[model samples]
Structure formats: C-alpha cells, structure tokens
Target: MSKKQHRGWGVGEQAEQHYLVEPRHLAGGGDVRHVSEFLRAAGWTDQSRTGGPLVFDSPARTVHVAYNPFVRPGGWTITGKANDHEPEWNVTFNPQTPVEIVAGFTDALTKSRSAHAPNPWAPLRQHGWETERAQHFTAVSPDRNAWLQFHQTGEGQAHWWAGARTEHGRTWDAVLTPSTPMHLIEAFSAALADPQPVMRPRGNIPPSRWIRTTSVSVRPSELGAWQQARISAARAATWARNSWASSSPRTHTPTPRPYAAAAGAVRTGR
Candidate 1:
C-alpha cells in the first residue's frame, strides 16, 4: 500500500495547540504579576489561577508555547549547572474538566491518528506532561508510552483549567491549562493502546451471567521476584489512579493542607 504522506507541514505536534480555553502567558517577571493581578481582579484567587501558554488572539499565526531555558534547558550545557534559572511559566492546563472543546480544535489542526492505529508515532505534547518535566501533571499510567505517544491539536496558546491548583505557593500562576482538547484525547488514545489485556471478552456471545474463577501455579524459585514485581506495579498503578482522581474538576473537593500541617508543627516546636 502507498504510504500516507502528510499534505503540508502536518498537524502541530505541540500539545498546547489542542486546548479549548486561551491560556496566555503573562510574559516573565512583572508580567507574571500582571496576569496574576488580572485574575485577582476577575475574582480568581492566587491559589486558583494556573500558568501556561499564551494563546495568541489571532488565527493565522501558528500557536507557540514559551519555555524557560533556566527551568528546562535543552542539550548538554557543555559544563556548569544544567538549568540555572527557575521556571518562569509553562503550558499547563487548568482544572477544567472534559477537555472536549480543546480536543475538537486539536483534531481539526493535527494529523495524528488514535494511538491504536497501525502507524503510531510518538505524541508531541507540552514538556511538562511527563512526571519529570511538570511540577504537577505527572504521568498517571506507569507506562511512559502513553505520555510519550499523546499529542494535542487545538487553537489558541493556553487554557486556564478551572478549579485547579498546584504545589507552588497556591498561586494561580502554578496551575495552567492546555490549549487544545486533542492532547487529552491523545493521552487516552495511547493509554488504550497499551499492551495490557481488557477484562471484557471479544466473542459474539454476551458475558457469562456469573463470574468464573481459575487457579494457576508458578515455580517456587521465581515466586519471590514475581511477587515483588507485582507489588511494584500495583503501587505504581495506585499512585497513578490517585493522582488523576484528586485532579478531577467535578469533585469540588477541598485540598488537604499537608504542607501547612507540617509547617504548623515546626512553628509550635512540636
């Protein structure tokens, strides 16, 4: 079969291009303060606002996300500290749920097929979507493949996920929204593509009315290592589940103050 050639430059690989809301940058230094102030004036608390890409108001321009060299420097610096400057801002998504609107834009802009298709290229997303890059949005699944393969196709620059918060001093600048919705779809798509088996059966007959049970045996010599690996995998899964669970926008749950509690204990000389 003839290979499918992309018509032009192909869809934007950047994840921010998929966000639904406009997550604009506030420049750096004073600009950060200004955007924070703007959100405050709009009745958003410092704890509620998020930092991310600056989706341009214009359509002709391809959306670009800014990266702070100090925070995440590219390539080896030859010598000296890797990244010296603290991260100024990142293309983060706000706590807004159901990234469908942004996803729609992403689907419109990008040429990425679902993660399951025959030609699966690595997903291109904002740098911080992975655990190592982001302060908050860590990879939920243990498989890094899902995080790596996901991409976003959207308009604007960034999004302000509503009701989201970050570990950075409860500042709105800490939380950010992805611009395109397609990035989320890509993440989910890649996750679905994982080699793990589905609990449901594929046969034409409906599932049995009752649950079935089976037993298996393993070599005693290998049991120790096997069990250890299983335990580790379980822990990873639990962490991923908890991470995304608490981030749900629909929950409206109050954030726990573990930091505050620790700080209070220290102050009281406990």
Candidate 2:
C-alpha cells in the first residue's frame, strides 16, 4: 500500500505534478474573467475555449475554469491537470471569497510553481506545536513558562499570543501581530527560543482596571521558573498524600483510657 501524501491548503498534490489553486477558497463569483486576468498576469496563456470552461495552460500545469450561476452567490469550479500522466485536480469557489484572499492564493500558487521551500510555520511544528485546525495552533514553549497560540487570518496575515504563568497561578498574555512577511515570522520564532524582557500590557488587567497604566517587561525565563515551581509544588503535594496514605493505621489511631470509679462512690463502699 502507498502512503497518502499530505498537501498544504489550496494546493493539490498528485503523482505527476502539483495543482496550485483550489477555487473554492479563491473565487468570488461565477465570472472566470477576473480569475483569467489574474492568470494572464502570472504568465499563463489561454490555450482554447469552446463555449464552456475556459482552458488555460502554463509551464507548470493546465487549468479549467467553469462557471456555475446556479450555485449560491454564483461561483466557479477550477480543475487542473498536469501535462504528464497524473491525477486531475478540482476545486470550487463561492462568491463570498474576498479579492484579497484570491490575490494571496495566486501569489502562493505562483511561488509553488517555481521552487518549493519549507513553510514558515515549519519551525513551530518542529518545536511541539500542533495545529488544532486550519490557521490555529497551540504549543508549549521550550522553557515551559508560556503557552503559545497561533492564528492565521485572511490575506495571509497571522497573529500569535504567548501566555505566561505567574507565581500566583495567574496568566500574563502578550499578543503579536507582525506584518505578513516571511522574514518577520522567522524572527518571531527566534525570539521565542531565547526570550528577553520586553514591555507589554499587563495580562491580568480587567475591563474596569484597564485604565491603570501598569506595564511590565516579562521574560521567558521567569515564566519557565514559575511553571517549574508549580510542578514542584504539585509533586510535593502528591508525595505528602501518598506518605499519609501508606502509613500504618495504628499510628494515627486514638488510644482509649480506662476510667476510675468516682471518689464518692469509693468512700460510700468503704
């Protein structure tokens, strides 16, 4: 049996070649002209059309864009095939897809056609972060002081937050929404590995106290130490519980004393 290969979102991977755009995430309407314009700008040439889906071919792959007016918001379904004998690719797009998303998808597709490189998020995955779903991930930092979360927004934009645990078991959160540059993502990851104190808004502030001008520079090492302390305390508590549970019952049992007769009763008997 052959292993099923995992492909990135908006990309289709088959035996022969990779299909770049999945229309469902890119197109906004049934009109293929807009999409065609995007393709033409990207160096694709219109091969042929016969009153049906418009066919376009590029050096990398061939594509078919079909209109479906009956679909809600009028959308397009795109199919791609590699020149070599390979599996076909199909994707559907609704009219609700924003133009920016379409543009971003096209840019990504263009890049994929030329050369393949490791995704920017590859490092996060290497360090223990697991993608919970599309554009969302959760991970614990190496220092264990902070729990980090990642979210990718529309137009290739991305954001992340680090939650630092404090001595009182409180969490201090810092959010970073860097520009959608690949280099910036790389720098952010590097910063996490060797965290330094940086001024950030206090995470513990409530809505009422939000006006308070109290900001602090938090360090990754501090958060790690707090996490370690919490672990140590937990271990101590477990040990104490187990020690008490394993001790002999007699050691804790109360002793009973015999009572002497009252002095008055003794005197009367004498």
Score candidate 2 by TM-score against the native: 0.29
Estimated TM-score for each candidate: 0.17, 0.29
Question: How far out, in Å, is residue 113 in model 1?
Answer: 8.3
Q: Identify the candidate with maximal TM-score.
A: 2
Give me the overall lDDT of model 1: 0.25
Give one digit per residue, the lDDT tens place, for model 1 in 1-270: 111121223244311110001111110111122122222222222322245422221122232222222333221110011133322222332222112222222222212233443321233222223333343233422322222222223454443222211222211222233322334334433332232211111121112212121111222323334334433433343345356754443222221211121121111100
Mind giving the per-residue lDDT tens digits that candidate 2 earns over 1-270?
111222332233222211111111111122244345555544566664565444566545655544445545554455556445544544443443323223333323332222344354555557654444545676665444445467666776656654444334423333445332343334344333322221112332222211112222223443344335433433343344346644433121111110111111111100
In model 2, state the lDDT of residue 80. Answer: 56
Candidate 2 lDDT at 17 equals: 15
Tell me the spans in candidate 2 whose CA falls farther than 4 Å from its real position: 1-34, 46-61, 70-73, 82-86, 110-130, 133-270
Worst 10-residue lDDT window for candidate 2 reads 261-270
lDDT of 2: 0.38
- Flag regions of model 1 displaced more than 4 Å: 1-59, 71-90, 93-139, 143-179, 183-270
